[model samples]
Target: MAPLMRNRSPNNVPNELNVEYYRQRASAGLIISEATAITEQGQGYSNVPGIYTDEAVEGWQNVTRAVHEAGGKIFCQLQHVGRISHKSLQPFGDPPVAPSAIQAKAKSFVVYSDGTSDFIETSLPRHLKPFEISGIIEDYRRAAARTLEAGFDGVEIHAANGYLIDQFLRSSSNQRTDLYGGPLENRARFMFDIVGCISREIGPGRTAIRLSPVAPSNDVHDERPQALYNYIASQLSAYDLAYVHIVEGATGGDRTYQQGPEPFDYAEMRETYYRTDGSGAWMVNNGYDRPLAIEALEKERADLICFGRPFIANPDLVRRLRINAPLNALDQRTLFGGDAKGYTDYPVLGG
Candidate 1:
């Protein structure tokens, strides 16, 4: 299952509602939890769960325990939204941090005191100092450690979606001249550092990462995506990660969208990883249906397929796919910041 932010954790702590939610979908072989904040500084959307605080960890403990008890393996997706966040979401209303001070052409979800929320323009961000970078990396390390404490089967670093890690990797977002921003290698330093740290904290076999090479989600782009991501795939060979999850094309949009002059070749990226001895499972996501997913596996293009929204409306998505049953229609009005009405209330085949 793909990570989909339901924004139901009012205090950044998963509640009983959350535990029941995951337990219902425990049929999924592996469920990737929603993008979870690694620190207060990493939060972007309102009500999204966090992994830093003791309460947050305790909240996730319930989630993982329920999933495990129901026979499901789950991974927590650690995330830092960087400049994609608004000051309202940041600690003490401070400006969000980014690779550069540039603001993203994006919006963030903010809930007002009146119990209402709306998407607001992301605030201008402050450039991250060299010293601050290490602190954030440490935050990721701590988050990874917390995942084990919370009883997660593994963890996936949210390096995609124009978040903090993705902000550092994209040339358009990163303008630093230091060891973290010029060439492809420099731009990828932050990612590798986080991956290495997490792998050390939790074995690489339990560590994975999600990347969106060509997806222009959160308004991020690199001059040479093909070259940049190909290099990343090769470098990833060093860590025998659990898997490499790639978001193909525009996230939640066009599946054939290209971010550069040349069309991004996902097959080439996988080949590069394999040639360089990266032996991780290759997972692909983005507008996939049963036919497309089967075609990918049959053609040996992907080892696993991720369904995001489909899982939102179908708690028994695994069985639905297996039997080729018609899926429940997603309620557009209740996609985020909602109760069980559109969440765990979705009926299954016989329930």
Candidate 2:
């Protein structure tokens, strides 16, 4: 897993494509890099890696080579933070840009030169016009082209976690009445269009996307989570993408609220996207252990499973699962906005 944007360190253990790190966890069928910014304005926090730059592409290419040398497959997650950014994080003190000008209620982690972390309020974004919106789609295409140049197995478009795509998908955030909003199809249009553009840059078989149905992270709420995601899944079915990853629980909220009774169930939600008729592969994430992951795969609910904190604490996660070995616990304090202390220092089993 790629580290969160703001949680990066100057050492760049997580964001940097290091040989040792990828060598350790090369067992995963496919390792998706942490959310990568599509542009400088797409950044949400300090030090989150960008895919738009030649240097960034070179850095990630080193990572891809490392993983590939170790017999591992990897994908880069293309992300745009939308309004979930602080002015301090933007280039030249520019404000964050989004589908709307509203400010996200979430606080981004800010790191200091001393390696300390603090929460900072997100800046209000400048709402994009029709022309600017088209520009953003081009941004995604460029980012996807870079990912292909970097030699990654594929690219996972991060439409989840209250980012740019999510901002347009949710009714609570998108209040526009134009062709880009007001109806479910219009809201999903931006995503589908971006996907189509990116697919042209890279083959559709090498493209993927991640979505969250009921996640209330970053203060995002939808009027109809079920219908919204159902339509999204159905619409996405037209593309011959690699797979779709879904975060099952509230990705950016309290665990209690996420596990509570909600209109959408995680298993049922997975079924919406991963049908047996072979629409595409489906990957399920959030709070999954070996047992739960195996169960999901057994029941055909998920084709692959992504483990976040578990992978952080256990670099040999695939081996641990294969042998049913004991797992390590992650240090929550160092989860975000940290150096390599908890980022790359997590030990492999018996190491």
- Number of the predicted model whose TM-score against the real structure is largest: 1
Q: Could you tell me which 10 consecutive residues in candidate 2 have the lowest summed lDDT?
A: 9-18
- Which tens-of-lDDT digit does each residue in 1-351 have in candidate 1? 999999999989999999999999988889999999999999999999999999999999999999999999999999999999999889999999999999999999977878898999999999999999999999999999999999999999999989999999999999999999999899999999999999999999999999999878888988899999999998998888999999999999999999867889998998788634435799999999889999999998998999999998999999999999999999989888979899889999988
TM-score, every prediction: 0.98, 0.91
Q: Each candidate: how many clashes?
A: 0, 2
**Model number with the top lDDT:** 1
Q: Write the per-residue lDDT of candidate 2 for residues 1-351, one digit (tens) a residue.
A: 532343462322234524455666778778888788888888777666777777778778788888999899998889888899988778798888877788888987667776676888898888889998999999999888888888889889998878889999988888888888898899988999898998888998899898877778786778777778888887777778888888775874433344224547555555555445676787878878888888888988777788777777888888988999998887888666655677678877667
Model 1 global lDDT (CA atoms, 0 to 1): 0.93
In candidate 2, residue 265 scores what lDDT? 57
lDDT by candidate, in order shown: 0.93, 0.78
